[model samples]
Target chain A: MPKEYDTFVDDLSTLPEGKELILAIRDLAPGNRKYDTRVVKAILASSANKLPEGDILWLRYQRGSLRPEPWRIKIIDEREGLLLKEKVYDT
Target chain B: MPFRDNREYIEALEKAGEVVRVAQEVDWDLEAGAIIRRSYELKLPAPFFQKIKGYPKGFRMFGGPLANFRRLAIAMDMPADSHPGAILDEYHKRAQHPIKPVIVKDGPCKENVRIGDQVDLYELPAPMVHDGDGGRYISTWHFVLTKDMDSDWVNWGMYRQMIHNSRDMGGLFLPTQDIGVMYYRKYEANNIPMPFATAIGPDPISALASCASYGVGRNEADLAGGIRRAPVELIKCETSDILVPAHAEIIIEGEVLPYKRVDEGPFGEYTGYRSSPRMPRPVYRVKAITFRNDPILTVANMGVPLDDADICLSVCGRTDIKTILDNYGFPITGIHLPPECSGHMIVVAVQAKYTNIASHIANAIWGTKLPYPYIVVVDSDVDPYNITEVLHAIVTKCHPVRGIRAQEFAVGHPLLPFLSLEERMWGKGAAVLLDCTWPLDWPKEIAIPRKASFKEIYPKEIQEKVLNNWKNYGYK
Candidate 1:
């Protein structure tokens, strides 16, 4: 059976403020040559205390990369209440 | 102050601390080309090669002549730190007043002259620019002067010339360009060889004017004169009636054979790709060569982004498009053709008062002389020069289905690498229009949303306070 994941992040409230975050999506399944792993970076604005739900975060897929897949977000690093780094896993 | 000649311009650059003198002997084959390319990629100072492997002491090569923005700013008689918008404004302001050329009896270009059997092009150390180039090119930064047979109007254009032999060179004259339509077409239809003169290193203003897309019958000599705020002094060619810059470093008088065609290209073009295939094009037969004592050859190494060609195209394209839109009474805020796209994409910021104004602007841009295939129109609030802001507008305001339009058949530049061999051969292509503006039919509440920006959400006092105390708040 193929592993499945969510394509969208349900909660972005956990992301720290005033820090840069890299939303990395990786393909975990082996022998899938067509799928591509990529990452995009965005900063959490300090002025905004909270991120509204359903707010869209545009992602760019590389040419010949896999289409949108199930993914989960993770806080890779946090410093001084600022979101420093992040990664998303997709199976 | 206006530069008297190419040498004077180089001197000014050196005095301004924007040029580097490379005294070490470098081979013309690839060593010189690699150095020039690397300098452009790294945004280094212009390289002045004083010693080429086979050339003599006086023979020199200046590479990436206009790659630096500050260098371009200095060339146009502006401040070294002048912004891109200021440079474009200066060009537009000067273009309104054209000063004609004044013919002179003689100049430095005539210090040495060779005709017939004595003329040898190989003596000049022309660098083999790219590794995939078909041959060494001697005319990348040079301007070709041609005149219509029936009309007195003269046209100056920058066209690449590849060295074919000791006396012959191959080049391209696309039918859509002003030079091909106004001058070459007339000669080709009549089966008569067109008289031409190639100015190797004219003043910097003349070189800039040569790359611009001035309308048909527009004389670039006058434009150069206008940009310099003085009439350019011209000296008549030895074998042709076409006049060239009197203070030019080197001038070659030649005749472009209308009936003759020679194989040229498969070289790397300004599009950041090696897309042009080897094909037969017009050949220029050298009849006379003249130059000053120990003339310097100016070369522009074209391949990737941030090169001299990108600088020229961005400045010229922006000025040309802005002038066109303004003349048509469009309330345009700003226009920019980013150099990263190699003049293929244009971003226009305009004030929309009526319905579908963005769509109208996009269509109008397509009809202009610009070679761009993709155009994006944004609201006045958006900054077209800022790529990130423009992309955000495209993402938020644009509807992928309704706001995007495509034309199946559009005039395309022959040098565009993305086109297939058949499409390029037929000179047929497509153009796209992207409108990144709010819909006019929607109500204010529906069309507008609260922006998540500091200036938009926060009160003016709080925003100002935060900005004023930014440095004190541990923000460097």
Candidate 2:
């Protein structure tokens, strides 16, 4: 099967530049997610290296919904600026 | 205990850690509006801009002066952390006693005076409060003072005024409003210019009193004096016979000429909508401008809830409704007009002794001077201040078909966005009454269900334990 969408890439810079990204942070986080581009750009410009494993970053160009349902992601493992993870679903 | 003037109120706010000063250069254009809007959204302290971009250092603009309950409490001379209900109770208790004002020879407002050609309206840093506003408004928080031709009754009213040029401004003067339009009609009959004086920053309590629903031919200055429990000091205006607060920060003396109309409005009103269109209205000709050195301009930022207008108007509405209901001998427990509704919704809690008691109170409210169109009558058990409890009462006790009543034709506020074109134009609207109380004639065997609540369901000891351990359970 194609690499699962939950699989995290190494450095955030390694991900395809134009692909959509989604932030799975708490509801009380500062800054609005409606302007996804600015949020992604700010994240990339930060000093953090590896993506939190299982975190899904949806780029603006890829999403159709203005405000999508909130998604939860959990980090599994990190090695050499890379993150490997899996999505957890409730039964 | 009452503030003598606006300066005293500002100093009190500053001492209470409720004033924020900005020294950076800011534009009087959209930038100032945006900053004030953001501050209000954040529920921060009142902002005082000391350095407007084009204006000099002495000139200042204050935004969201009474945004927080703590600030309002201080302005009313109550303890800083007093509850809103207590403040209203105090105001109502004081309003019953009327104290007349004392006129003095001179005060700080006369430190500098400009008359004739020296008068310039553009010198003051009036801000464009919203992007879609028609123009910069200068008299958002101030009161326009006018007197009747045949009587000595002086009226203080809050009306929006737009700056048009160096010496002239335009404003809306609805004929139904007590002071401006009514006075203009009397002047029109005699064919004379109606003398008027506007005070920019007077004592905060006096400004609050202007928003009350006192009947026509009653002097608001006297009512303000009653509320303050001390006589207000009045001084003569330069160009008119009108009297203004002696200690006001700035005063503008002028006249409203009969048969003269100019274009005004599209300004965002307290209804949270820019519903009013630009149309021809009365023009105010400026004859004299008086102020203290480096006077501060107070602006009420409109278009959103929890602003100065919402707080003051709601307090005034609650006090007036309570006093009216008490005079009628209705068993009233509480009255409240939530700020978020912008004076459109009124909630009354009462102990109903008869079947139609709720309906009677609602109809009486409709007949009052308050302009709210939606009213909710809840039983004494429900807390009028708690929106969730009121909603629960409506959902559980009210029957959709039997408990609701509607008055097809009632006086509607023109600024309400939901009104039709005809209703807005004619100033006529409908009123709805929601009776959220149980039927008194229900069978005794079919007992009313008890409310399922923590205090109702749990044992007394358990409830007391939970309450005492609330902080320990990490429920801040």
Candidate 3:
């Protein structure tokens, strides 16, 4: 089974990476989730002085310890609501 | 734009070119109030004071934060011009499904720490936001903590804290509020002081949530988690068992002595008037302080429209009123937290699915948790956000005795100006529940024919062309 995060350091950096990656883990969290990713793209676009819909992934961090990875993950868009979800794949 | 904290929020505004930073030093006295008032009158975004007349260079101040409902909406991660009704609906929905806060050991807020004797309140440029104020108030945006009398669940609320001295602070102890009631009960049983902590500049959403009058026993921090979706990161206080935002700018850990009370305010309030005269209130004794480097202080201007007092408190009242009514199963169609009355007046629009729906909604709203609502419920189509429409429903649809209900001796909001006007003014007033639903026997459809209009037979392209080229007709 996939590992769960027991510490803060692991939780912050374990966020899903991009669109394809986020789709796999959307419904694992117990509460409703809202994903806000505009800034990731906006910051990237602003730095380049051009708008290109920069890539920033969003996902819901579900409840449950990482050693057993009991929760699922839900991806969402601020403007569009829910995007996708994926079951925690065991190692 | 998204922000990690108040400092980060301001930084985002500056980066987006939405804010104008004043480099020149401005006095924290009346001068700051004047500048803030001018910003509101001009409908400009709030200003950031990089340099104040007093205090160290790194001590920054923010004024007029969330002065407008639109701005408050933006802070809640909604569109700039979103209506209060829409925002509150979302708030209620989020409250039911809460995301727990994440516990973190360290963050940027720990960059600098001040504990014990080194902690000096005078070092920060906390502004005397209003004239004739007791002293430079520090609690405009601070969260005051008190645990539930029965449960250990912590209660966080944005009650105003006034700076009396480096070691002492005084705050309102209104008997109606949860904090006041809880503290009094503890004092009565223990016959000793109750320890409390005041946190300044936590995450913006958390600060906003604290201002909301969530029902007793429910932790406002959970509401903050709901607002953010992701769990809010929290850190335990160094001096007390209380938990504060890991990223908060400053935390003042203190206790309120059971028998001690001091003169707190003659300060201007949200009702567009200064409270009659000075009065003694409960005092908070500072025992420890923890802060980050170059900490930024936030202030809310009182005594005028669309200031932080209104924006923040209004959201609280609005959310509380709606939540209470919804909890009672009232078919509420909409609710408005008008900036005009500093959110004291609440107008609810109900669908009125059946007869007496208006009266039920009105009574439900009036009897709800937030004490006095000054409620007016109209037909769903009336659009409660439109002052003109709400008034029209009250005037045309409501028959005085049939629609209105009066409540006497009900507790009033302390900030209400009318309270201080008369000798022992009734701390209460009558609430009108306009029965705007059509007469009981009336048919649903209107019998009259449609009025004539120019667009009846016009094609879409032709209508658009006429509108676009209207000036060419020389109508002027």
Candidate 4:
């Protein structure tokens, strides 16, 4: 339901096929921030539209708050290193 | 009779203090789902979200509508304090009479409409349930309406659905399910798109009726009416001829395209685990959307025990099994599929009429629609709903060797985690039957041992005296 999700989905859909890899990180703290289940699910869902036939590394963190960085996604193109990276969304 | 619609059902829940109205803003992203999950875990009242973070003021959502037996009792129009077994008995009795649904011109679901280019599922607040799920699940607790191609049979079932952009939705449609069989054998076989309609937040009985494991060709609408003890009012879908509950809060009319598939699943399931990995599944192409002015999206936050799916399956599955055994002259007193077992096990209490009756009961169950793996048969004196009583029978009366019968290569459910990869893919696994009833051949005096329960060990006069003076002698 967030604007960032739509933007991410668009980026994934338009990517060049078989050229990029993705690294998705989600924060799963023990406290209220544990609500990041949606962040994990949404990332997996957005990855469904990925045109690139590359590996996806899903990582979970226990860092207590700064929960602002609940989820981060980085697109890595073999030669370009990091292509598109988003570190923080609406907290 | 059950409540007329979700509004009436909610009122009953509210009066009984079984639901909480959440007035604060809650994010549909994962926060809303997290609260629902916690509610189920704690056996708390249902949560009605009056204010969602991004949605309109009136677009509400409900979480864990049937989280406990008390709510289920209210859903069935019984006292909120009724026992679990009593509720199950009431449901089983209602299932015996299938009243037909009546058609109506228009209803609350049609108060607002979105058609053609106006349809956008993302506009609704379908929450992302679990962290590792596929996407925002739009149809967790709703019943999908699909009719038979060559007959008048219409099936209503709750199949988990995920959003695939705007007009497209992906969901599980296993070839073994009723809708799957109809689509695979008839619609897809004939190369035709299967017309469908989905109703969210219908009457309490109707929503549960959709999830029941009834036989094919028997309409769920009729079963819902039977449960309500009154005819369910239905209205025609805008794009398709399919009928949906007139009082439904929201309705989406669509078609399942022939030979089309989309990425679905990895969502939280009733099995208390994340469902199957993301893979291509059948897609439903939305044609129209209809709803009330302030529609309430019913969310079935599946996972863990005592959730809506658990309550529905326990009561509905119990009736299905009990009916089958009764028809075969098994003399069953009760049959329960504990929501805790997540549909993998069933406990049956039966009077021993002859020798080795457990195998016949297992065979009868395997032939039915939903064949579970672990079946436990206890004496009629034992209450299947009481897990303590069931476990006692199993540990004491049942012989370690003679009572447990394991059947290799038996029928199975595809979602069970214990099955091998091959078995999960093909629905083949080992099943067992545990006979806890005393053998009829055992002599009355010496061979059969006496139970240590209060009813069996205490004298009638002493029991009466204890009960009569319990409060006077330091009890609460």
Candidate 5:
């Protein structure tokens, strides 16, 4: 059988606070791709870095050129969070 | 329709509140350019010059109003901070899978037609954009229609045309550019002058795409169709066999004759300076001038950095880079054509799956038309968008001797002031590609200091709690 595939955040709306999203990426990122998760984080953090108070920075990060893995950021309920939707386009 | 014509696109701009109309009479010389230069310096929306000093009331002029990065993104239906890489991604997605343009029988551009000796080039208000410019340039946003001598392929490109008089003007049909090469071959083989048509004030997307280096023989108009998600309506010109975008504000139909020459520039080019002393350039003798009832003149403020070079050419370079790398089967994580570099400086981030991946990326870039006069390739970990971060990767990951490779004797573009300044013009120059990847000799499991320190992490509950209380803590 093909290695059982797991779906990442199916709906970006359910993503929790900042630390939770980072923890989720840590779980998903493995071995050679360890640095990719960090790259995604920096890109996500930048959007919210200078937002006015309570303006959440919602963002998503995706891989590949065509269909970028849905990496999104939104300021939800005064908290910044990221939603990594799926492995969009494999290199 | 992708856009019915130039007027339709202008209407869209007006509707979006992205354009501001200056009703005062503006001179084509310093006043028009000053307004444009100010818009660029302020990094504001594109400017529309409603009145030209000598032109009629209805004869509109478009200037710096929509020239900056912010306005370009707005027009393309993207967010404000849409970087060059992101925009390139947009173009790449469209170019590879182009939505072919639909053909229509007639369009508004056909509303007015002038052919033969009646074509008066002097009637149009082609802006004398900069002080040091040799003559009034008519083709920054102007697209030239030329066909291949053998295969009969059509090429659309932005070549500079200057006004010499009512019937003639200096044109840069550079040997490297398709127009120059096509004209050269036709002049040599059939002993016939090359027929050409110039269009100004078409759709913003078409104007922007014309600035792209879409390889030598590729049809940019079709590529433009893919971006607009509809066909670019084209109408046959009155005097020439060439076809121009149907809605172009104005069309200059003419033939470039043999043994005809004029001194063209000393104009402020995109390199931020006058292109040395004026040199001999090909002349396009206008045979006819066609336009809609109320024709709008388009202006591209040239020279002194941040003009067409950054906004137009840089976007083209980045788009081509990403597409070229992907086509070469390289794991290019990202690419950036920073505005500061006049789009000639390219930084690439690639996933280093194997040894010499950096070199591979470098080779891929060098082999393409968008080769930056300077290139730096880095490990996927570095953010190509972040200049300081890219530099850090270069400093930390690269060794001077082992990392640097040079390609000598590359065909350089004349606009590259650096190349013209160099001693040898033909392939005598060299390009530096830095391999800023981890040393290939290192162990696969090598350990580096942990990047996540106490400052980088916090419990989710605590972070959420603090953010929720941000107002209570006195910071908005």
Candidate 6:
């Protein structure tokens, strides 16, 4: 069987070269998957401009943890914390 | 205050407490899409992701703006708590008088422009909205603006486009749709590329107008203007002569290569299924990608009920059926495409004045681009909007054989799950009109069965007394 991505690419240099890829900053961790992508986003966005167009590869790192069914994704917190961290406390 | 742009609409949603700002980063690879889908299912406020996982700070996304009737009502400048029926009436009334769009020199979409080789479609985070989709789609909630090659007619339609590479995208342009008519009949036949521009994250009304079952040559921009009761400002495209909504968050201008076909889709469409197969479709060779600084990409999770498409087609598809019937002089009191059926069925309440009126009604609906498989026509006494009334009529009033017409070779949508690949390709299928009205030519003195209800069976005195004494009856 083919392999599945369990963790995000921390080192972009190890990624395969010479093919068009969909670069997504994903985290395979549980609960923190939603927020964990932030550090990876910064990691990729920092170097994305320098990378070749066809070489951008995205590894969809779910690790089969989060809800696969779209309807199963729950929205529990209806608070201002969901907004910008600074703006939530500004006013 | 009225909505003129996507930002204005978001502001309106924020003011109404109908928007949730996701400060936490959401992955575009499916997690963001899941959140958007959940938002629709719960009938919650629009989810505006301020921070996408893969993109920079300014590039945000707004999903399911008109996911509920309340948000839809706000989009149309109506009361937030307006009933869905009244919202439909409001939309239909405004659609009667289309206000032509006004052209402007420059707009927000022109704020940041990348032309030719500078265009990288990946700069905007195109969400892979559903798992197992063929690729990331760029145009889910947007409208494709294309002009008729032979005439001055321009059409704006909601067609999905998937990004193939840095400079190319592909989408399904069905032959039956207006865009397909322009592309296949005029452009492809003549061996010329068709000029096209798509506006993403326009005001909510424009998106609804784009999905409406508009006849050929009926401009959606004008219908949008009519619904909003104000002219939609448009800006000239960079690469093409086609104009796009001025305040749109982003505009992708390109040309459809005449003979070029590319692999596209297996998307989870509005029918709550991946109905359309992954196949070769028309290619959009991107010439320019223009947008406002820090663009807001409108994402539509079109898999199940109460999604953006369902919320829109519920009103628009019903409007088309009712309008077609009214123009043909059928005495229809009300019509509804329930959000539950996802536009697969329509219920029409009518006064069956003559023989075979149900057939006429079915045929009228079938003639439109959006035809429902289940056409339930009941008597004027029934409420088409109420599913219980429609179900009761279908069970009791409809005869075994005579009252049902299982129509073959009816127009079928590509997104319909039941159709075979070949059938969907040819746009042909079967439909059944459940005629629930009593036969007009029946000879019996009391041929029509009595309907028992507070509105139908009870006398004025009894209904009044019961309604007046409801408090004493221990009913709150």
Residue pairs in steric clash, candidate 2? Answer: A10-A82, A20-A58, A20-A59, A21-A57, A21-A58, A21-A59, A22-A57, A22-A58
Per-residue lDDT for A1-91 in model 6, tens only?
2111112332435443433333322222322122121111111222334432312224322111222211101111222100111101000
DockQ, every prediction: 0.01, 0.01, 0.01, 0.06, 0.01, 0.03
| lDDT measured at residue B291 in model 2 versus the true structure, 0 to 100 | 92
Name the weakest run of 10 consecutive residues (lDDT summed) in model 6 chain B: B258-267
Query: Candidate 4 chain A: worst 10 consecutive residues by lDDT?
Result: A82-91
Interface RMSD of each: 23.7, 24.7, 24.9, 13.1, 25.9, 18.5
- TM-score result, candidate 6: 0.83
Q: Please state how well chain A of candidate 2 matches the true chain A, as a TM-score.
A: 0.20
- Write the number of the candidate with greater TM-score, choosing between 1 and 6: 6
Show where candidate 3 strays beyond 4 Å: A1-91, B15-17, B79-86, B400-402, B420-435, B441-476
DockQ, 0 to 1 scale, candidate 3: 0.01
DockQ of 5: 0.01
Tell me each candidate's TM-score. 0.82, 0.81, 0.75, 0.84, 0.75, 0.83
Leading candidate by TM-score: 4
Estimate the lDDT of model 1.
Answer: 0.75
For every model shown, the clashing-pair count is: 1, 8, 21, 2, 27, 1
Clashing pairs in 4: A37-B131, A41-B131
Tens-place lDDT per residue, model 4, B142-229, is 8999999999999999987787656777787666688988898899889999999999889888888887878788898889999989
Ranking by TM-score: 4, 6, 1, 2, 5, 3
Can you write out model 2's per-residue Cα lDDT over B1-476, one digit (the tens) per residue?
88998778888998998888888977777677788878877888888888887777888888877776788899878899998888878888888887989999989999999999998776788887775465578888889998888888788998888776567777776666786445555886677888889998888888888888777888888889988889899999997778899988889989876666654556778887777655556778899999988888888888678788888878888888888899999999989998887888888998888898888998888787556788899989899888899889888888897988988888765577888855765667788888987778876458677778997778999999999999999999
> Residue B426 of candidate 2: its Cα lDDT?
64
Q: After superposition, how far is residue B121 of candidate 5 from its true place, in Å?
A: 1.9
